[model samples]
Target: MSNLIPDPISNVFKSLAIAVSLLVSLVAAPPAQALEPIPVPIDIEALDITSSIDLHREAGNRLQVSTAPGADGIVRRIEVPSRDGTNTNWAVFSLANTSDEQIDRLIVAPNYKLVGSALFWPDLGSSRIAAITPSQGIAPERQKSLEADVFLVTLDPGSIVTFVAELTTPNLPEIRIWEPDVYEETINAYTLYRGIILGISGLLALFLTILFVVKGTVMFPATAALAWSVLAYLCIDFGFWGMVFKLEGGGSQLARACAEVMLAASLIIFLYAYLNLNRWNIHYSHLALTTLILILGLLGVAVWDPSIAAGIARLALAVIGILGFVTIAVLAFQHYDRAILLIPTWCLLIAWLIGAGMTVTGYIANDIVQPALGGGLVLIVLLIGFTVMQHAFAGGAIAQGLISDIERKALALTGAGDIIWDWDIDRDRIYTGNEVEDLLNLKRGSLEGPARDWLDVLHPQDRDRFRATLDAVIDQRRGKVMQTFRLRSEDGHFRWFRLRARPIIGSDGEVIRCVGTLLDVTEERTAEERLLHDAVHDNLTGLPNRELFVDRLRTSVVRSKAEETAKPTILVLNLDRFKQVNDSIGLSAGDSILLTVARRLGRLIGQQDTLGRLSGDQYGLVLLSEQEPDRIVALADSLRKAVRAPITFGDREIFLTCSVGIAFF
Candidate 1:
């Protein structure tokens, strides 16, 4: 039975081995097969009707009615229809020319033309017929006229030829009409428009800048209108809307020449307008006028003597244009901020870049293109003019408003505040208004000239900090500086003032002056000082109380630990039966004793030392001296002995022996 059954472990091992072998084979093997190449689908259906026909039409059928295709095969059959003859038709196209003289005498004409569309035939494709709108038949011819090719065949008088009019079939692909000669006659038209715009914009910008400098009456509205017009024209040109559609007489060259002449003239005029050359120099104005006249003369020459104008003259003129604009840009960049003048000039300068870009990537030109590419700067001048006008009108208003705002704020600040002061750092003057006297009770006329005028007036404790703040405010050029300081009064008292100010902006956006307000906060400050005093000092004696003493003790302990050479000591003492004596005499007598004790301690303590009334009949002293502990103990003993002197308060001999605590560092 066991032999018949399969070994489970061996079977499992065999399966595992097979899987491992398969994985190993996969790891060691090359890829199963090379990837198949994907084929790009060529959609010949998208080619233009003309290209398709040119590609697909029969080689023999490449002939059109136009003479451009030299003499070819015979037009086999001719036919036309008459409106009355056929069911409501016009003329018949199917007929034989019974009387056929030479084509010089035989003529056929169309009564009307369809205004809806344009038609073109292409001969290039497998089925080279590009059918646009299915089969659109033509109106029937009124009569028969046959013209035979002289080389192919000659028709004698009265000789017959059958002619058929068939517009029933179409064969070709679709066409994208956007792509044409990218830059052509339209460039001239657009250039002319742009030149006009540029000239106007430049003139306006110049005029406005002059007005801003001279602070004069200027024409801004006209400039703005010109700018808008230029922009509109540029948009129209760039959008390619019907730019070359006006080429009727003489062809595209005439239209282009017209546009170029207009735009170029606009540029010259704009330059004059912006610079106000008329006012600046009479000779320059006349010269500018002559240059313009010469440009006009050049246009006339182009129209009349194309041979001369098309020769080396154009190259010479282009060089002049480049040099003149470069010179103007260099000057404008240094002296004036005229984007119109700069941008238009730079546009002409980078023609090479634009040309290269357009060549590498073919672009479709539109109707708007004529006004843009056509050497017309009329639109550009107009645009600059309008911008200059806008800046003149609105910028003046803004600057004036800002100045008024600053003045109003300054006046308001002085009037509303209890103190007004000026820090003329350069002039070394600290001028305070009459209100400062009211706020600080300081000598009014004294602070007008020098820093030392008020230097001696400050509380000895606050003098350094007050001087530091003043110096910092000016040196760092802080904006809207805020300072809260105590100023010494004529009465030998200190008063608090909160000074705040904003810096004035100059035409160059720099701070030219500081306008500030000083509010008298002495009363509020006094209240705050009193609150702090109550929190840390005895209300009656004005000495540091128990809380302040403990805080000082902790600070001394931290300092003593840091210094090993000199350690801090705290002397704790209790009165020698002073409580019993106070009860025997009275609480008032004990109070008198305590007051005397507080006064003595405060006097004996140095500037850095502190003295405080810890509690009734208890006092503390802090001594910051290099003296030994015995000397400190002696000082404490002296303080205790000083308090023991009998107090003569309202003719009463109040004697009290007290213990004193001294902390030494």
Candidate 2:
């Protein structure tokens, strides 16, 4: 029983050991041969011939077919492992033409910037080969087609041939098999599409550049830079640069890298300026500046070392992506109109960048990303253009409003005697209507020069004041000016002119021009002065009224107190029998007698003293000089005598006696 149990246990251990050994052998074995035979479709015009293909990455350009490895379950578009530019990618696939006739096809690698490619046909036999090199150009065996690199392949009926494509490019390539006519048609459509995109982008760039020159706004130049950078990148991507410059493979790659770096840097710059982060938030602005500096530094590094430029550009895109989203959020929070407008476009751009980066890094295939990139770019451009146009339209509306205002003012100032003038501050030139010279009574073209010439025609007292008002308008960059000054006419008389000016500010907030009307106010000033004089004087007697006398007395008292001088003396005098004289004579005779008394008193008082008609038959006098008590009494007696001696009203000799009262402060 013990022997039988041991035998069964030994058999079980042997079975387990054999199973472990088989599993180890299978795990340690090399990958299966990838050269699977793929049947060519006899019915289809074009075929996505990459499903059975195998991709293997090998270091260095000198790859041997014997050492090529295999991969399985590949799709129409496959992402091969990427390495430095020195590495070679091999795609192995076998094609069997099952038809009775021979099939001619084109093997296409749809990348414009492909560095170099080679094809080994007839079951990977190097004897039959087609190759293309960057320096020597295309070989006879390879076809020169549109933007994509092309290779010729022929399949015989009932024959199976494995093909190996050796690709040496920075990124992995997407391979396709196509008929000649279909490829030509596809290329034609692609060219047209790319042409439209490039044309629109170019026009947008030019428009923004013109705006920058015309308006001098920060956002214009920034957007222009971004537009130009995008255009350059598209040029490189679409193979236009290659056709124009005919650069070598390395040089072309370097140019592409530089273009990409510039694109990212320009995007960062545009966002910083477009969002107005510098003015809105201090900390974010600093962060943006720092990021910009880093990007510029990367650009410098790319110039110095082109091999790592793509990596640098990717890094820049990533950095900007994070910072840009944060800034957009902040702007949206603040309810910035432009930032709100930019949201959808900015999101599309970020998505494209991410997808493109993934495609380049082999996280995704090129086929999916390429189409999205094209459509996204166009959409982003359209949306950004729309947003920028809002600013342009807003500026145009403001300018139009200013023009309407100027037109209205001009219409209002088109009166027969009004003189309209415009001062070009920068050129120091003054332009005026012909009426200015006629109004000033000067010769023709007398005031048709610089602003200083106009100033020379002004009265000496008004010249400095007018200049000061104009300077203030230009310096402060605010407010309109309404100054009333005197301008000297040719006849040596100064006429008062009222100047009403409104300054026109440029984009930089500087007063570029001043427009105004010069209206003659000489008659108005004369009327005003006459009215002022009549307000303080008695009409019948033509002497200072009681209000004027009181004002003068108050001023004299304050001056005496301030200067510690003698206080002014006041005397009130009344004519005796004045009411009896008015009652006997007519009212007209009474008025004439009062006028005669006022003239007599005016001749008695000095210019420094005040003489006034206080009321009917009453007079008041103020002496502003220091006088002894006897002198004061003598002055009061003189005033009384002057009023009492008035006579000869009409045909009668009116006589009067006066009583006087004196007061001292």
User: On residues 1-665, what C-alpha lDDT tens digit does candidate 1 reach at each position?
Assistant: 35654689789989999999999987985334211111111221111122211221221222222111111322322222321232221111111213334321111121111111111111111211111110112221222211110111122333332222222123212222111122224335645655565555545545655544443333333343334334443333332222435322233233333333444454455556555556546886787788778766756766764333323233333544564566466657666655344556446434632432242233522323323342334433444445555555666433432345666776566567545666665566667767777655655676677666666666677667767766665556554667787777766677777878665555665445555667878899889978988999997778888899889867766776877534555654455777886887788767766666677767766776667677765666656653587888787787777767777766667666766555554
CA deviation > 4 Å runs, candidate 1: 1-417, 420-432, 437-478, 486-494, 577-586, 600-609, 622-645, 648-652, 658-665
Q: What TM-score do all the candidates reach, one by one?
A: 0.32, 0.49
**C-alpha-based local distance difference test score of model 2:** 0.70
Cα lDDT, model 1, residue 509:
54
Best by TM-score: 2
- Per residue, candidate 2 scores C-alpha lDDT tens digits across 520-556 of 8889999998898889988888778889989999999
Residue range with the least summed lDDT across 10 consecutive positions in model 1? 144-153
Clashes of each: 97, 0
